[model samples]
Target: MRYAYDAQSGQCLKFVYRGYQGNGNGFDSKEECEDQCARSLYDFA
Candidate 1:
């Protein structure tokens, strides 16, 4: 499992899981995860 957080607020923004069960979000790479987090921040702003 992996988590992405907001730099300023230090709050969790995303959660990614890598397993056979496939239960949570998953990103191809860390860069992709950060990109998604950035998009979500802007989307709510």
Candidate 2:
């Protein structure tokens, strides 16, 4: 499983990783995704 960042929702969500590839959005632990992606959204808000 993995997590990805949703741009419209601005959140890190979980999902199953299929095969062997990278989604290129925010594939990582939810905490990492939030720390690296989602949380920053609130900084400007």
Candidate 3:
């Protein structure tokens, strides 16, 4: 899996195993962006 996030706008996405990627935009803060991605990835463990 690969993840890419926009640091400026806080848009983020996760791409997995040749499937269609997911994306989001317009976060209120950087902490929110990091938190969202961390939570999403945490389930993989």
Rank by lDDT (best first): 2, 1, 3
| Candidate 1 off by > 4 Å | 1-24
- How well does each candidate superpose onto the true structure, as a TM-score? 0.46, 0.63, 0.41
Per-residue C-alpha lDDT of model 2 across residues 1-45, encoded as one tens digit per residue: 788888888678888887576657646588888777845677778
Lowest lDDT block of 10, candidate 3:
14-23
Q: What is the C-alpha lDDT of each candidate?
A: 0.60, 0.75, 0.55
In terms of lDDT, which candidate is strongest? Answer: 2
State the lDDT of candidate 3 residue by residue for 1-45, as single tens digits.
Answer: 455565565456543434445446334455665777667767875
Work out candidate 1's RMSD over C-alphas.
4.8
* Clash pairs detected, candidate 1: none
What number of clashing residue pairs does each candidate have, in the order they appear? 0, 0, 0
How well is each residue in 1-45 modelled by candidate 1, as lDDT tens digits? 465555687454555464667533356556766777778879999
* Residue pairs that clash (backbone atoms under 3 angstroms), model 3: none
Q: Whole-model lDDT, candidate 2?
A: 0.75
Over 4 Å off, model 2: 39-45
